[model samples]
Target: MKIRVLGSGHSGGTPMIGEGWGNADPKNPKNYRTRPSIVVENDKTRILVDTSPDLRVQLLAANIEHIDAVLYTHGHADHLNGIDDLRSVNRAMNEWIPAYTDAKTWSDIVNRFNYVLEPLKNDTNVFYKPCLKRNDITVGQQFEIGDFCIGVMDQDHGFMRTLGYRINQFAYSTDVVELPEESFKTLNGIDTWMVGALWEEPHITHAHVDKVINWAERVEPNRLILTHLSHRIDYETVSKRLPEFAELAYDGMILEL
Candidate 1:
């Protein structure tokens, strides 16, 4: 299996519009992040984790043309806003994509893009808008998408709840601050864990550097890749602080398992 880091930055992404790279170096391309998203794929299937606001550019940069499924972590704008860009994929693939998410997240998505959730018209060739088949999932549920057998667990995002996904030995937990006991049990013994860590300091809604390290110590994954970074984190400086088993995720980084 291969996991591609489509975008690794926090909600605002690195080098915010009004505020430039906070602690990040301008010379390091690794600090030039977009939004949070990833693509998990094996030889037969490609599954997108989230449609980040930078999905278009991210997909282009990664040279990804088609995806079999989309799994949403939550309804945050950074994670869900770029959903409209999936229309281009719909047009290219000539089929409706299957998107999986919790009921509340689906509700938020429906409120925003109701049209995309509507049934496809009889004329399938008309790909003017995104056509998606909604598959409402629940915590602790297990499902299969192509070559993946996925397990879902509940995550606490402080203000709201999100879903973490486990597929084979690789698990993804983004936009989360607290992993419930059940979620940690689900993540136990994973080989690679790509989790969210906004910065070095403690955060109300997202996990920080120390917090993630603590979690990693418990789960003890062979490789721990931190994602959903903020401008407050400088690549070179933060890299030195992490243990040898852990590393910061950069845009376009690919991990083969």
Candidate 2:
């Protein structure tokens, strides 16, 4: 399987409009993050995780021509707000795309993007709008997209809950502050893990370096990559602090398993 980190920055992204680069160095390409998103693809399928607000540029830069499905971690603006960009993909493939999320998240999405949620019709014009089929997923239940089997686990994201997905030997957990006991069990044996870490300090709604490292210690994946990073976390500084098998993720980073 091949995993591509389309964007690794937190909600506002690095060099947030008007805020500049914060602690991140302006010269480092790794620090030029877009927003949090990733693409998982193998020979048979291509699945997107979260449509970052920077979706248009990210997809164009990645030269992604097709998407088999989209798995939403939550309905947060950072993750689901760029959903309308899927219309480009819809036009590319000339078909409706399936997006999976939990019931609450799906409900919010349907309510927010009522036009996109409309049922497809024989005379529907996909070019004029995105055609996405919302599939409500149950936590811990396994589902399929092409040849891969995916499982979702509940994650703690402040007052709201999000999802972490496990696909084969790799798992992705973003926008999470804590992993429930059941979530740990679900991620126990992954070979590669893409986990969310907001910064070096503790955060209320996002994982910090210390917390995620502790989880990595217990999960013991072959490689641990920290994503959903904030501008406060400098690439060089964080890279120096990470374990030999772990590192901070950057936009456009790709891992093959």
TM-score of each: 0.98, 0.97
Give the runs in model 1 whose Cα sits over 4 Å from its true position.
121-124
lDDT by residue (1-257, candidate 2, tens digit) is: 99999999999899988787999998999999988999999998999999989999999999996999999999999998889899999999988888899999888887888888786667766467887887889899999999888999999999899999999999999989988899999997899999999999898999998899899999999999999998898999889978987999999999999
Q: Per-residue lDDT for 1-257 in model 1, tens only? A: 99999999999999988788999998999999999999999989999999999999999999887989999999999999999999999988888899999999999998999999876678567888898899999999999998788999899999999999999899999988999999999997799999999999998999998899999999999999999999999999999979999999999999999
Candidate 2 Cα errors over 4 Å, as ranges: 120-122
| Residue 8's lDDT in candidate 2 | 95
Worst 10 residues of 2 by lDDT: 119-128
Reference-based lDDT, each prediction:
0.94, 0.92
